[model samples]
Target: MSKVDADTQSKWDEQLDYKKLPDWKDCASILNKRCQYLEARDSKQIRSEQCVKTFNKNSSTKPTIVNPHRPQTSLAANQRSCILCRDLNHSITNCKKFLELSVMDRFWKTKKLGLCLNCLVKGHSVSRCPSSYKCKTCEQAHHSLLHRTQPADTNSGIDTPSDTSGQSTSAATHSAMEKEQVPEAQVILATALLLIKDSSEGFQLGRVLLDSGSQVNFINEKFANSLGLRKHRKNVDIVGIGVTETKIKYQTQSTIRSRYSNFEISLEFLVAPSITGYQPEASLNVSSWNLPSNLELADENFNQPSQIDLLLGAEAFFDLLESGQIKLGEGLPSLQQTALGWIVSGRYKSKYNTTKKASCVANTLEVGLDKYFEKFFEFEEIQGLRSIWSEEQNECEKHFIDTIKMLPSGRLMVQLPFKKHPSCLGGSYDIAFRRFLSLERRLSKNASIKSQYSDFLKEYERLGHMSLVPNPNLDEDHYYLLHQYVLRPDSVSTKLRVVFDASCCTSSQISLNGILMVGPTIQDELLIILLRFRLYRYALTADIVKMYRQFLVNPSDRKLQFILWRENEPTPIQTYQLNTLSSVFG
Candidate 1:
């Protein structure tokens, strides 16, 4: 018989009414009911730390009922058997079965074993329960006492005595009659991802628990086996919590890459049984790396992962923490001032997961020089640009007319004509002309810009830059049509100039400048001056007014410089050809 049963029988012998004490058969029935109730209750309550979770199945060979780490041949001859389940591996107080029993059953179990009444568990008395739950009736923090149920007159303020002993119960007796009602203890498990490495392989991801309270680091045997790590045969004692005895565990050395930083440190870890509870429904042949969860920001339940393959204890945790690779939360209570109210809450920052994605979107239009240049390169293929220009042509023409009206009425306003109608190949050149015209009108509002356009043309005409092409001079080849605009309308200077494009394509898809020449290039005058300074220690510079127009061009080449011009809408467009090498030469 168990020591509890023997103790219960001895207590019955000391009772004043020995004949009224329950018989052995009745006691057995009560014990059976107690076990059944405890089992039912335990099925309802879930323990997060000790809860069963499914893991990678490739590591398992077959489904087994016993502890996977414990050898089948191992004997527990010296271990004390639990009074509730008769298990030799754990004590009665620590038995999961007994701990789930109801308050009444728990009380009887303790009383029968001649144990404390306050804490139904053995080895403690009424003064100490170590429970955090407060009383549901009296608002006190003690187990609820079973008060005698007595029918009383509504007018009377006292409860009639209901005890069969026919005597008044004292406070001490009432306290002993209280049942056990202690809540399960809560534990904080800090889990993170660590990079563990073996001799023959690169660093691999391993789920680790940062336990600063533990004296040493630990790695599960299954995890180490998965990594194919070699273990040293060291018979080291692993002491558990409280007065629990130590067990032998093997030791192994591994290099762990920190989750927060690039630091990799060598650590000695004890290889022990897997700390995770097993799930029976999990398969036995799955092979896959346990990837860390990619959590979104709004996921409220930021609990640790289900499985922890390693335990990084004080030896490694503190060192990592001191090195700024890990950090811990403050244990003190704090309040935060928010728009709603003062919120009392604690925050924990994990070293492994620094940030979470709040939202995602596809950005195809990010602005950059390369992106703009890419669009510019694709300008020929863009059909929408043609339609856009078609819609805005009228507005562009109206703006151009308004700019012409704004200039002095008597201003020559000569129209540049072409020797022949230029090919508007794919009409891109027309689009370019419309853009130039619109931009010119918009820039004409600035006084500095208006002067630049007028001054450049005045200089060209005054220098006899070009002459009217003779009516008899018959030229079959069409001259390229050019457009002009202020180079920098924003700049305020008398010399601020306008640039006329000479690379415009003709109807034949060719530019006059493009076909004119392609050979040795002219030396940069600045570079020439610098070279002379190096040779002769002297340099000279001068401004040659209309030097390009003064340089004579061969008369035959003048045909290629033909242009069309008109003073106003009423004047007919007239043709002219350049007789000077004044314009920007190709």
Candidate 2:
């Protein structure tokens, strides 16, 4: 194990070479021949008789040698309290109370003391005792087998404790029921890596928490839905410490395989909400749930998802525990067995640390497409909508520029404007432009992306979303600007969309025309909307197609939304101005 040990072993090996020695039988023969040669002694010594006398003397042995100076017993050794009589200065065997008892009574007393019948010692029974003494009754090594006494009927005349309150049996039952209804521990949660077996996917890696006290196993709704699991609706009440009168409204059947002990089991799980009331004490705090190091889980949506999923529960836990399929270690309070494959609980030493608030730039998705759909669609309906949007493009961009051109702009028009624009938004144009160029190059080779972008541009051009301006018509009267493009793969439409930043900088000065725009908020304040939704049994939800592009700007404000555009890499660049509010206007 260590360099020192290895060197020591090598040095020890150099002292002997067994391979160079004589064969076993040959060596034995040589030894025998030497013994025969020494068999004869000098005639005056009477060698044969002398040899017999020497052998007989050595054959008979005495008790093993011990220190001659040490006493047989010490004051400290004798002072320990006797395990049997609870007395000092002597052990259980030599107790005066034990000696005074009858033989049969002593046997029962020894049994009560849980001592080794053979050695008359505590800590071990006769079967495992090292004593060589045989049973006094049967002359067998096991003292328990030879000693038999009829069991006493101690409860024959014993009366059960009666309630002093004179309550009826039903009332007593109610009191007992009340005690049983409440439990001490909320849930014993064990997080382990598991192998889940699916009909289509044989064994996939999963992180699960086994709840030994629960009546049924639970799977996270989000995780289950991701796996495309089929569900059956059921309203099952869940009663626990600090839990509300709540119910699990769904159930699903699935098979989970644990390779920890090479075991697999199929069962139906009540699809409970994995995210319940957050209790700092009830959750495991770890860097990530993935087994070993979690670098592999970087691409996944959850580095540490719900701590409770696949609760083994009372129904399954006891069976596995008894069969030796699940082994628990007390030192680290870890569980190891087959459930997901050989898995041990991860290190959960720290308290739950609340995540920090993200910076402004990281909050780009605050008013994103994902957020808009979540506000309107129900759980299952969102899935269907996403599937459709992924393959289809909207047609509402056809009239944006046309409508903007028709709007009258005169000296009489009132301007609602801000004095200062947000300077932080100005420096990102070059980076966004480079990203757009990279996306365009990727789209050139990808048919799906190319077709999706083509359909998007077709609708935008047909709707007059932008109007081209000749190079000669460019004037100092308007501030020339450019909008960057963004590729949102997570969205339903994985196409490149232009990002219009009206706050774009021109030579470190804010654009006066850009400052003259005011946008109307379409989404309602969320708190009030949520309160109203909860009050209605039936409510209508609608999403306007091409939501932002549907709103048109005045012809006077269109020039402030100008951008440089080229149809192809070799084509002459042209100036174009957007006529509708794009995604960034939010």
Candidate 3:
């Protein structure tokens, strides 16, 4: 081993002097143990510092401990002195005066008492509390007594529990004093799982939320894209709680069907980037709650947090609701009968100190606007706006510049800009093979198309665009691209062309295009080019023959561009590595 650093040597010397070891062996053992202890202590200190920094970054205000050096107190001792009424006979839970306060008021009282939200115990915050017990209702890390509940009719807007009785004046005074101490309430929204028809007429199970407060129906943009539905451009502003606005740029129509009954409806939804964050926020235990055994739940996993794919607004909400309704209890979600099925909604009572209420509003707009402004200012220059590129796009451009080289034959050689190492690209040979078999079956029905495809491959091989793999066994970093043909019967130059599917998913459910960086557009738009052509006295148009083949890929990356093929059924399938850049690849 190398000699110890100065700091380490000094530490060892100090330990040895203090211990006064007799032999070198004893001194070494003691030094080793001391070093481990010091290392652990330093690591722990570093972790604590990191945690504090993270906490400070997330919290708007820092917590203040009035007496940090005070001796730790237990729950039994705290119970003797109620924070609400200072009663010596009973604890906060049993205190009659505390029970008289509203749920919102109780929440503020708990905050003021400086007790742990999870256990309502003194001496530690919720994060440091050793208790594993959580709120029975929401299963969140909070005491059940402090759990707040809102009305089931979330569409009517948030209704704060007010003490509107004889003590209204005093209640108002207390409310004003504890306005800042109020925490966001957490309430469960009505969600259901319904069958949504895709473009292919196939039905997919999607999680839909019933939001009567929203004037128009909304769908998650990513989910809408996955359905392959035709979208029409229709920009509109969606305003939600606190006048928060989000721009919806597209709208699509989809048919939804009930899983239990023959109920079906066609609905139009405005597409947004995201509907809302995950519902429930966290998972809940529903085993204890006695639900109706005869009723079939729309969403079986309503207790679990999940992505909301579609939101049915007021237009559809009222139409779907039936007259049937069942109340479970005062603190439990009530089952409401709808065309879709029985959906659980309403106030659930628990003892959590605070709950983060989930709303149909888009809360991320401010952060998005901040980022947009930051980018706008960053790219502003004397001449005009500089080219704006994301970090991924910039990295892609740099990768191309760094890895691109000119071969002896004057062909440009480049490496694939993979976001991750190639080893992580799981097995794709089976998928490619299956796709190839399907393509073969389709081609067999048309002899002319099959012959044309064979000729194209023959020409491709003749020109050295691709070569047979010497060994059929795939390497750890290998990938296979599924190949298909696109028929351009109207084209004079090429009637048939083979296209490689770079987006074909592997066993890992990730494709080459998914992990690869699609570099920014290097060519000008067609509209811009056409407009510039009009400015010239003479305009000429030409096409470069075999344009995609001009650029060659590096030898090391050839394995990742493998394809399977067989001219005839009698012959075994063969693997070929593409040597040149293809137009279809991202």
Candidate 4:
């Protein structure tokens, strides 16, 4: 009651009769209902007043009655205003002030106003702008006002004949003269020479860029390969300026250490084909400029253009900064102390008067609407219309037909259809050993699963489907398949199934399945098979046990299907070759 407003309380008190006062509980409920109604009424009145004020500000004339049926349209119209002039009378597209500005000036104004270049609107960035409007001049996603006209003779000068009339030549020369020229300034980016750990357990000097703006670190693919670092597969989309998109397939981890100091840190970086174009753009003459002699510079040749091998993101940037800093004269780069060394960055005036073009580089990631629609339509394609055989598939089938042989025991043996020679597969023993250790730990937790899995492998060996390698140290091209078991409690036949992973990648980042050609589908679809089963007068169904084991793999191909196994803890782990057809292959 004390919290209620005075006007509402007074109205409620007047409504009560002294001779016939209601019960205490009923009176409380009535008061609560009255307070709610009053609060809602006040909110509605405040909103209406705000709306009327907005309408009055946008409209120069007296307020007119807004039709209830079309209130939304009137409100939307009143809310519309010119982004450039902030005038409610017209939108930015129709604003005369915006159209009068020069092309370069319009671009700067749009950036300064924080308006979307695509739609010329505020509140959202160009990358996230929903409007699909494109420039009429170039059909780009930016507004027409931002499009720049190119000079005619820039690329077509050689195409013109020498016999052309002087008037035509003079017009071409005039167009080239009208082209804009801007002075070039040398800008130094923060870079350092750091030691990065390689696959051989040695450190190598690599050029690194320090960027506090990036959220994730990146490494150059060529540099990463030079270091011989093992990369793990990771699919990530990288977006850049103007919402341009790219993808990274691999990432690697390594330790970085300062060359002059003992400061060391480990980092994970996504591997990109290239971080960016060479830094500094061109060489700079530093004879006239003065720099501190006592400072240990991060990069000795910061003024020279060089490839960036790595980019340290914000996660490592802040930690490397120190309190020490030195500021030079105006139009000169300043020095900031860091873990690596003193980093020189900022603007630097050059003595050369040559004209050069400037460009902006930004890395961002975004999935556009077109990509989603493309993926959605991909699933809608008719699979039956697609060609069944390709060049590689035909070659694979021919190889199988030529190499296949029948054994004396009435079993067919076929060679694995490889896309390339098997020598490309590097060492896979370590990878397989780690996976086997992991499987052991998982099976240790469940005794019943462990027992069933061991029995299945023992049964497979008893059937002569696999055999132990005579010498595991044989110097030959080999691949190891990672094995695991799958459990099915409801199954009436086999309760456990041993599954081999042929897609496990080695140090070379190449898997056995990656090099092998997947044969075309020869089996009918399940729907067709079921429909045919119903048409028969009588149906008989049977499942073939160990169907894959019925066919044998060639002696040469068996080496590629090696596996690590042990029957129990007392037994030593031994390498075995699968002599029969593996389920991983069709």
Candidate 5:
């Protein structure tokens, strides 16, 4: 919402019929009421006789519907296609093609920087994974330092200050063999021997890993074996991706952030999700592992430490990120316990898409409440309502009816079928389920409360009394106004009062937040003014009817930058648009 839009909304609200208006100050308070249904009426009259409360309307015993202008819609275009994914004109943020695509465009680029967090998988950067160099320092919390000292023996090449065990000069020469330690970085990167300590369930295995990107503890066969850990049970689900090895090198002594001598290193191993083709969920038990002796021998004979229950590789990393348990260690806690790196940053992926199809209709029938059914099902039955769909989806009609009949959650899922879901994405089951649930709006439509919210605002102006009404279903007008403008964080609805006393003029400035309000007017007339004050600001007063109800964040994240209105608030403001922000009450 813009300042002009807000101001315009105020003007029209002032011009509405104040004599018949209701008393509610805002829409939220009105909708918050718990009323379920109102008695039916046959005609359009101010006085309603069938309602629970017999209200007066001039002077007549009449029966009439409370709101008759519910179906009013303005003429406008809806839904823009996604630009990157190209599947839709709308941005990937609002595209429902695949959540993975959304994540790729919205999160990976800006978050990953140059790291390859998704090296084990497809479509991602590497920076998302843990750094391969945090092990050598002393302050490392878990592992304790222990160095082996050899007794003095010139023959064995064990030059020590004390007496040495007697041995042949040849044996001494063999003993003199120096164990050149491979740098921890080289070891992690060069080797692919992720441990599989417990493999009793032949072919089924689990392991431990050290993924700094992870939050909570998880277990995977590859991660377990990376630390060279042994387990009691076999074939147990490791619960995470395989632990991979990558090397690190430290050559400079002065390059330390906290404090420590920097040694040269290289990396190779990996910690990754163990899912077969990204299938099979691992049952993980998160328990802290006891640390091994922390030995930081300047000599190249030691290994680094790693520790984590299920060190989520690139794939599983974001699942548990919000929980916030994955951490980076300061020093050598133990091998496989601590991750070494210049810094550790988490990478997240998001895929959210919603495509509503009205031209695309489904075959489902709606029936009125039954005697035994009314006691059980208060709303219409799924079988009787008319459906404009094909034979395959007609089963959905029965499914919808049976759903509400069989399960309690079914009624809550009131599905109003339409050609709502677009056929695409190899057409997975998840899409089918979404299409099934899209049919519940009929109840609101029949109840005549679809426009209950907006109508109540208009009524408040007419009757001067408080009333509440239910919102419309998906195929209805662009309902996202509730979330985008009304409820979205930091939206205009937050800072400005929907209704004011007209005395205190505390003005607030608002932009579209990148959210385009779609499908405002199918005709030229203002269907009840959304904003009573202004018409157009920035010449943006158009709306699209087709909108993405739920918007997933974008992928690529390359051009990702959150425009901040002020300092101290570091959160990036990535706005997801439904279609276009041009739609407004003109």
Candidate 6:
């Protein structure tokens, strides 16, 4: 026994008071709190030590593994497993079974289980007969004597019982119950996802959202374009609690869409803002926003594509939470049918799943090295290719056509940056790709690679390498150079002729040549027109967005210009793209 528990028991014996004596539960509660603090502290220390070891090991081992070291720009911090379903040797896929375990198993393992008479194991009264005897081999007379001492009448039942005849079992059986919510202020109340069936039609993924605080809500852009709602635009600022700075760039646009040629409707949720925001203004009709949920995924198997319209999301639901139509605590008291026409209770505890999904998801999303888990969340395609990445096809062709990253072996890996469904990572390959690329197998599998590389030409970008590090060496005021001066808003000849001088002597740096009326570039042409009405001296405003991010030097080229942030730190290869801009006065 723990020293504290032993002391507590001694005090209880001497005081002859059960209330004064800390029971196993009370002692355990105290220990649990202490253990939590200790575990957190130890985890931090272990992580630190591992970091140091990682450096030392890198010194002796392969340092910037060429392909592996390539910087990857991910929006999230290391992935997090579902707190409730992470370590129960099961995933959310199997979470339903978690509820069948003892209450303690459920609490520590998943939200599925609750503290109850079932887990307490002492739910019935001793006089209930069968429990009075300790063994099946015991004499029936002995068992009967033990149970008979107590009168069968209610008055006696209510009164003090005879000695060693009756005992209180579960406080839960006859008492009220209360369960508190998780301690996070930002919690998801409900979520919905959708699929656009064709250019003109939309279908509901058999779901709608009723809560707020969801990370992201999406709609198919293709669906939006077909609906012809493109002309209507909604630019909403995502402000408020827990919003990231990058979200300022998101602007909402609308489009019209429909489902089945016969079932034409409009869909507009698919436009992703450049930046995602918290209090972000989502595009919605608000009061009139509704979807036809009559069409569910024809295939219960999530592997195949679903014929759906728009996935109801943060736009429609977050607005509802502020109005209090949605409650955060208990699964709703009543089950409501979706517009798609099915009985679905907000009681989202997956009862229909034969296998637990929680464990499957948690184990799959686990960050560290474990091939089985990493691929658990990934899906296989028609020919049984586990990932879209096929070595038989070559680098550019690996991802069918939509260019995603590649493992060393050249395979596609899908991570759902904004998935909030009950079964977040379910089914097979066809669905995993839907988060980023369209799943239509139209036009030979090679259609995606050409556009992927061509998009870079649209901008005068340089850092091409910063997609991997936490910080970068690029400076500000350089991004303005990315746009190739095309044409001015007003028709006029620009006097400024530009010169570009860049070198790899240190890090890639550029110096622009300045002169007016010498060249007819877009910037110069615009300057010439503006000068017509204004004085010779003009206000030259210059700004750089993500300067450091734009100049990412790939790890392989790090020795040339990438400098270390610390003496022993892993040669901090920059991750996200940072940019820089500069301009000269005439």
Best by lDDT: 4
The TM-scores, one per candidate, come to 0.24, 0.27, 0.40, 0.38, 0.15, 0.22
lDDT of 3 by residue, 1-586 (tens): 1156676666666555433323446546866877788766766675476456435465666543321111113333343566567776545554556555566566777788888787665656776555556665566787665555433322321122222142222344354334423433346789999999876567889999998887888888778877777799998987777887777789999999999988899999898877887877667656667887878898888888899999998988998899999888767778899988899887776443334455655634446777776756543312212265557778999999999998788789999998987777889988888889999999999999999999999988999999998686675688899888898989999999998888877888888888888676677655657666656679888899999888889998888889999999899999999999875743
Off by over 4 Å in 5: 1-161, 164-440, 443-455, 459-512, 515-586
Better of 4 and 6 by lDDT: 4
Ranking by lDDT: 4, 3, 2, 1, 6, 5
RMSD per model, one decimal: 34.9, 28.3, 21.7, 22.0, 38.1, 29.6
Order by TM-score, highest first? 3, 4, 2, 1, 6, 5
TM-score, prediction 6: 0.22
lDDT of 1 by residue, 1-586 (tens): 1334564555444543434534456656655765676655554442221224222246454333332111122232115366667787854434555544443455566678755443233544444433334333443533333111111222321121123344564443333323221122222334455689864446687766566667777787768876767787878765554544445457888988854456678888878765443211111111121212332111112132255677777776655543111122343222322211122223322211112222111111245889666655454231211112222334434443443322343322211222333332222244344544565566556776666565666666666776665572433544534545536547544346534456775555666554432222224545444545655446677776655555555454565565554333365545666666545522
Q: How would you encode candidate 6's per-residue C-alpha lDDT over 1-586 as one tens digit per residue?
A: 3334564546444544444423456545655766676666766665465346435453555422111111111211112122344543422212333323332333344223321211111222222212222311223322111121111121221111112223542233112111211111211222233233332223223323333443444433333434333333445443434442222222234332222222222334434321122111111111221223354421222212233333344444432222112222343222222332222223322111112111100001123557554444342211111222223223323322352345574433322111122122122212222311331222125454323322332232343422234543344222111111122336343322221122111112222222111211123344345544454445676566433333322233232222111111233311232112222221
Give candidate 2's TM-score.
0.27
Name the runs in model 2 displaced over 4 angstroms. Answer: 1-439, 442-447, 472-497, 509-524
Off by over 4 Å in 3: 1-386
Distance (Å) between predicted and true CA of 536, model 1? 5.5
Error of 1 at 540 (Å): 2.4
Query: Can you write out model 5's per-residue Cα lDDT over 422-527, one digit (the tens) per residue?
Result: 1111212232223223322332343433343334334433442222223212232221121111223474322311221111111122122222212111233342
Score residue 428 of candidate 3 by CA lDDT.
98
lDDT of model number 6: 0.28
Better structure of 3 and 4 per TM-score? 3
